[model samples]
Target: MSSEAASGMDVDGGAGRGGLTTAERTTIAAAVNAVLVHCQMASNDANFKAAIRARRKLLALPTTAQCLDVAAISDAVLEVCYAMGCGGFPWATPRWWVKRRTGGTWEDLRQCDDATDDYFKEKLRMSPRVFREIQETLSPLLQRRVTFYRVPLQPDHIIAYALYRWATGETYDSGTCSFGIVRASGITMVHDVTAALLTACPDKISWPTGLQKAVVLRAFADKGFPNCHGCIDCTHIYIDKPANANGEDYCDRRRRFSVQAQVVVDMNLRVLDVFVGYPGSVHDMRMLNLSSLWVRAESGQLFTGPPVMLPFGVRTNGYLLGDNGYPQSEWIVVPYGGLAQHPTKARFDNKQKTTRGAVERAFGRLKGMWRLFLRTHKCNMDSLPQQFVAVCILHNILIDAGVPFDDNLLWEVGPDGVRRRVDLGMHQPLRPVCMESSTGDALILRDALAERMIAQ
Candidate 1:
């Protein structure tokens, strides 16, 4: 742009009294027009016609209007500058991307906040307190700095959008309508929220240690399982068939497309460990062996605490409880499973069932709270695992906050939230399963633990 053209829009939309002079207008017009004419925009560009009309309007503005508004004059000239730099006209912001400008989604979301706590639980799968805690916790990582063009969504709002979507399992299209956002922005909101949660999740979930390990051990001992650290279980997260060659592997005993998650939960139902991303067809024991937990355990890195002496001279440092889905190990105790169950073993199985109910109850509550696990997932296979882990972290967070679970929530939550499809372009081949039940120290530990339990 020429000095004359730049000077015409001087002082931030302020101009001298009276309209621009005929000669000054002529200079500005010629300079701006020269630039606009020479700039090449694609012939098939959506804004091509709008650009032509903008040019004609620029050419027609009366340079000699003595009473012209300075603001109008500035806008007129800058509009062309806008067109030259940006492919669209200055006013041509994409309609769908900018839907929440005024009395739209943001206001509606605010209005949905009634004084009671029920609204947040139903809408976000959590109470207001949990929501705020998460908002404050994720703010540092999720909050984006304001750019000249747009102010980012608040951490609170992003978390709400993502949580509500997960809790309700609504499709993104309908979710956009509910939230007053366009599909693209809604999708970005989920991504931003998921990323922040994942980054913070590792710290939220882990095996019991220090003071926590003591509390967990005492809690389980009181429940009739001595030296028990926690319980482990597996559940399936249903999904739509993948749009890939190996999509069939995700199908399981239910013959549904899904993935498996191996969760180890403490007595209080907080998720201590998570291993997900396997096809739903994989056996439970196979999933465990493939996990980092298994690697840590097999390397003698896990259960390093001092041993607890049991009946019959048996001892275990600490052990996890599981159902027959997993064979017994020195570090894990599973029940006897033959036609003629011994009275000692039968009595122990009853206790095992009761204690291991924590894992089953944990899965029930997890799926109940996060409707994501209730229905077939619509996200990428790779994305589903991270999102599952993220929600699990939230599960532990809510538990720590003393948020009570209402069994009725499962019946009350509405249809699934709309999910926009994501393709991370990754694949998993079915991993093979099983080692014969160990007759060694694992059998001795089980027998000792069972005998110890029946005696109690």
Candidate 2:
């Protein structure tokens, strides 16, 4: 029979014409077997149907050859199998192309020997050395959780996916496509990586003590806020409106939905402590009051020493520089608010504002580095806080790695002293009750600091 007649009859099991030649029969069997194996089809009927469908689809495409061969048929079948969630081509696997394109090795996708240091720093917001270190640190902890039966999700892939999500705030589907992870796996990777970071990197967000506390104090002193250990402020991180009954509480004064994150940062713009998950409507001071830092400071556990003697015999505990949103206390210092400010008070306010800017700089760097915090994050309300804390951990990591802060972006503090995006208009009128009554000793310490500054 003619080749065309033979090819036509081949589909009908070669019943109407001479049976297919050995080579033709072998090619058809191979194509069917490939569909069965790659697509995981259980029945011969399903495998044959998939192979025929794939062949027809390829023939219908504009770029396809008018006639097909065994290799072409196998390629078409594999493409369809992959699309149907069966298996992936070697070049399309995250273990293969993602590593090779990003300058990693084929044998070990995590290695960075092929990439320059700047490539990792710019792309991953970490140096190659840091990435390697983190990979090693997290691998043991994450291996069991992140691995799937079909494929083992490497620690590098998990870390890269988390960093990419934090840096861009992209959706899970986007991440899957970018990182070669499936949707469900991508979500799990982010969750597992975030938990791993929080578990393994607590020091990054710890309270200062001993030599660390002394170092922080000295750094703030150099910025003209004497005996100051850190700057305190709260900024709103936008989030999707929760679907719960109390979702309204998440709306901020600006009428936007958000969650408040109160952060304390040292002069180096490293976050020392972070309290997150408060609804946006909560006042910054209220959030502060609820923080463990506040609890520790009020209980006298945060700092222990004879009251630090300042110039002119003023005695005070190490204090945090805060904006008007916070009340001045033995451990917290706020700027002067009255219309009639003494020259000394004005000078003090000036220095206080300048010094308190460290927290703003810290927030700016945080959002700028992990832009996921800038916009309304599209994550479950319960998971949002973990995401925020995860980014803060990464921010501290980058700071420790000496990644320069992006100071070009400016954030504004409202009249009530809460930090908000600059483009959001002025805050609601300041409320007197928002400023808790200052203690006699707290007031006296402020006056003494002001007088001492003027004297200096």
TM-score of each: 0.74, 0.71
Residue 124, model 2: lDDT of: 67
Query: In model 2, which regions exceed 4 Å deviation?
Result: 1-116, 145-149, 406-436
For model 2, what is the error of residue 124's alpha carbon versus the real structure, in angstroms, after optimal superposition? Answer: 1.9
Candidate 1 local lDDT, 321-407, one digit each (tens): 887777778887887765688888788888887998898778777888877677775787667788888889889888888888987
Best by TM-score: 1
What is the TM-score of candidate 2?
0.71
Positional deviation of 262 in candidate 1, in angstroms? 0.6
Model 2 worst lDDT run, 10 consecutive residues: 98-107
Assess each prediction's global lDDT (C-alpha) against the native.
0.73, 0.71
lDDT of 2 by residue, 1-456 (tens): 644453544533445555456587567667666755654443356656765677677666344221354345545556555534433322234443232223332123355476555555555667777777888988887885321123465677778878877876678776655666667777888899989988998788888788888888788766666777888888888877787738779888888888888888898888988999888999987897888988899888887744667775777778887777777778888887778987788888988888877776777788866767776666777787897898898888878877665443345466899986643211332653354478888877778778777767
What shift in Å separates residue 178 of candidate 1 from its native position after superposition? 0.9
